[model samples]
Target: MNIDEKRFTASTEIQKPVPTKRGKSTTTWFALYGFLFISLALFVYVTNVLLGPLRLLLFDPPLFLRINELAIWYSGIPLVIGTALISWDLFRNVTRIRDAKFVRNDPPANRFLTVALTAYNDERSIGGAVKDFRAHPLVKRVIVISNNSRDRTMEIAEQAGAIVFNETRQGYGACVHRALREALKFEDTELTLLCEGDLTFRAADIEKFLAYIPHADVVNGSRIVEQLQERDTQLSLYMHYGNLFAGKVLEMKHLGAVSLTDVGTTYKLCRNVTLRELMPLLDPRINLEFNAYFLDTALSAGVRIIECPVAFYPRVGTSKGGNVNNRIATRLGLRMLWGIFVDWKGFFHD
Candidate 1:
């Protein structure tokens, strides 16, 4: 038999088993309620700290006493309830909900990949980024989706031998959604690698992603490794810790389903088959906070996600996204929190 036939026989002999369904209703209820109550308590505490001086200046003795009493009750009640629910869920049900079974599958029969790079006014980095990924032996094609760039990003990408498309929807999420759709059109490649054209990530990490792809439907690139990241990158100390906090909250929300870190990174690898199924479920209207939304929605639909450590470096151009400043990053983080706790549809307003 030929190599293709041998691979086919091997794959057919050891098919991957479907993940078993677990009872997660109770876990989801407790996790959401616990997060809600704790967040309320923290908000109340911060509010009191900021308004303490104002309270002293504006209120007389009787009124001040009443306000203080109300503050204590507002904070204390949520704090107690949140703490109890979390502790009970942790000790009682987390283990049972977690997937403890061990299963192994054969490596992919076709390792060739279609790479989609998201670009927006990245004239300085587009050419080099295109050439870098095109040089990878496993990368069959490089696609650049320019999100209505006003610069020479599309021109440079095309000159560098990248197939370029313009996504006129005008948002990071829209660009990414367009890139995925374009990558999914290729019949020669079974894997779709999604990344930015800002040069923060490199093509060498494709091997790392391939190593983990057999175990997950999506292999998310993680920038949390201190040793792997460059010192002068956009991921400042504040952004780094904030990403970790958001990741932990997501993990807690799913309870025992998965462990995650660095939900803010744009570099990830998805099986084409998986993306074909997950596309209809995602909302491209989720602007800046779309990565977090993608992960949450994927997990909610039982998609297996695994993290791979990838090196991060400084981008070539001015920052346009959340890492531009601490204030903006905080706002984006809060929006992520709101989507996680409240509803994603409410994000359209604020």
Candidate 2:
């Protein structure tokens, strides 16, 4: 059954315009008088030439297509354009964005963090990663998962302040399945950042980024190509072009809240509720081909994602992800593309 809903204007009468800041008489007396001055000059010049008695002046300038004649040219055009632009700006109202309020779930407790390290075999650098995660102001817990590591990777992670979870019995997805459940056990976990254990980030900067997310579903840091100017980790030309293409493709899709492939992004912010809701999407044991495999899934379930521009420091340890230089990565990208087409219905369900 269709029900008719009647809606009325919410406010009373709209307000009238008060004199604006720009409405003040400007200091540019020249602009206001330029036209009048030119008109006066032309009038005097014409009068001197036409009046027989006035022609006796020493400067009875002959109007024989003189220098200033054709040169009177379109000089006033700039003044008109400038005035129009100023008037447009002066009349337009500057809008202010209201800040969103993110509700806190639990009473504030001492720094308790549940940093998720999704790793395959980051044994060489897992220790450093855990230390960095623990160094945060309130990180109380570190949940590390050996996605499919064969070495002493889990042990190194455990020693570095993380309670390592083994997923050898299940697929990488299933390991994340188990890891997230454990991370959520702490009642006072104010922030949870799901990160791969291979990359390095400034702990302070990461925290600053997280603080902005209380009102946002996801706060992403976009890569600034400028920062990489002095460094050699320049994004391959192909990757740069590919990323641009991907951005345009996203616009074409017009999925208002849809995220980019990088949205799984090296970093992600989670409100406890959003995290809790997302855990179930982990397919028990498939390596979850893409780390952001759950992004489209999350949006389908209704989550907001936003990108904030930032500079990324080049990788310090063994890099797990980078320019799509290899055939494997290329194939993986193709798969993602194909999935986008086939699952458009699910990805944009909202």
Candidate 3:
């Protein structure tokens, strides 16, 4: 087989499994969301119950207590365990930030980073996205993967000085996998910046990424900063908290030593060596939650990851990814967690 054929075969050999009949149940989805809502509410209520004494000391005591003593004993215990986990994460990040040993200088202008962006029906924004990255002094070339976009995305990207490629496979995971593969092929590329072909993220943040990339194999962007996010962005209040909650779960699972506040961001910088070593082990069939899967696999391979706070703007076009709606994001988040826990071995094997 030719190189292209071999690449195609490697990507498809571990394709995502076909869904069973039970997977089509709408009732089960409702139950899952219901369960999540109640669990979150109970945790919040119990945490508040634990703070009752301190709360009363700071504010006026309420005539009627809303929390029951039973919940304080039942849920509060689990809350304590959860708090311990978060505390440990906080301690680690605090030490890393405060210690001069962890401080890293930004990459010099000569340290060029190749940019790769994934596009799917983003004709309206791909050109601007490409141009933004190309304008960056540290960016050598901008590469865009138009994942079967029927629009003018390819034309616009090429017009904006990007090397455009078509990815026939139709998943966010597949598109990203293709982008990474193509990025590593460039001999000049030392680091690759991967992002979406939408205007949600800007090129100005590339400097921030370079500063953090020296300390980590992968520097991931975090949109959790309230001040940096534009109004009415794709990250709604529900989606924002949900993403953070999922990030916390992931941190607890594979990366307890590091505190990760955002695992869903597509904009990240990865060393060429890290991608060369990491991509072959990734299963593109993992679908919309590929970022989490990548992080899990990278951590397993001992890749250091750090988050950089980046500004988030409202997209010029509609979102086509899992963040299109809260329901879609929730489903994707569940799939991510399921993959992390139950289907751990499945990602490596078929």
Candidate 4:
């Protein structure tokens, strides 16, 4: 072959597209869009028969009840199919969690776990948060990331004996990424506890995380337990259900065999190995719903995860995250869902 011909062949081979199991093909995308179009058309048709003028325009008055009956059956098919699928998944997850055995981590007298707290204008509770995590027997050091806080959050955290660092990039995901990065810096850090310094999640729940860490690569805390959750907490009823729905959707996406009821909780434990492998793949540009993104990416990376109930207390200061209200929480949930099902890499961050 000629030199130019060989060079062109090499360039074409290098530029060839590679198929990925994680991404959908063009044909699959078109088929999905077609299915959605058909479903939407059916919905519109049924609505026209039930509420629109088409019922009276096309059908006789005596046959209106028959048309309505047909419309009911047509509209109810999708709902029935959807409900049955959800129910079957729920039943399978419940049975799996109920029957599965978990190994608990029993630490020795020496501590090796590092606690990392993400802080953003949390001066009111940073000190207490630092102290609470330090009080845990298994926690060796407390690392706090002050995400460009305009207040005294860094000072208070440092005063409470925490190793504080500043992340100039302003976002919850950025702060958490920095926190995990700093936690891994310690030589003796075998496991990293990631939490917020806002005091919504207490340090006392570390034992629950420890108990579940041996069973999974990452142990996520679930605040859905009504008895464990304190009264007047920031997690309202609407926010709780939204978190539960997002968690279930994620569970179905990656970890269908396991049951998950909370995805927005900031309290979680990660083995150093999994954290090192998973952190590099995460995009810090993801904003308020970063926890869901984090969990989804971890699961996609083949990280085993299990959720354990943890006590959730009301924050010492005002809320800044997506849990401020139902409307904001719903928006964040929708973003999380989109990131999970669609193009996660290009959803929010360029």
* Model 3 lDDT at residue 69: 46
Give the alpha carbon lDDT tens digit for every residue of 1-350 in model 2: 22322222312223232222222322222322333344445655555345544444536567733534443434345546545543443333112101211232222233345677777677877788788878876667678888678777888888887888777654545656666677677677765666667654444456555555643555555453455223554354554555444443332232333335342245555666667877776454434343445554554455555555444554545554434255545544544444443442232211
- Alpha-carbon TM-score of each model against the true structure: 0.84, 0.58, 0.73, 0.75
- What is the per-residue lDDT of model 3 for residues 95-116, given as tens digits with 9 covering 90 to 100? 4334313323334334688899
Model 1 lDDT, residue 67, Cα: 78
Clash pairs detected, candidate 4: none
Worst 10 residues of 3 by lDDT: 19-28
Which residue runs does candidate 4 get wrong by more than 4 Å?
A: 1-71, 80-111, 255-257
lDDT (0-100) at residue 216 of candidate 3? Answer: 71
Error of 3 at 289 (Å): 0.4
Best by TM-score: 1
Inter-residue clash pairs, candidate 3: none
Better of 2 and 4 by lDDT: 4
What 10-residue stretch in candidate 4 is worst by lDDT? 24-33
Candidate lDDT values, in order: 0.86, 0.52, 0.76, 0.76
* lDDT score for candidate 2 against the true structure: 0.52
Give a tens-digit lDDT track for model 1, residues 1-350. Answer: 99999988876676556554622433365666787789789888788766777777876477776776688668988999998888887777756665443434646778999999999999999999999999999999999999999999999999999999999998888888899999999999899999999999999999999999988889999999999998799999899898988888888877776778888998999999889989998888888898999998888877778889999999998888898899999999999988887778887633
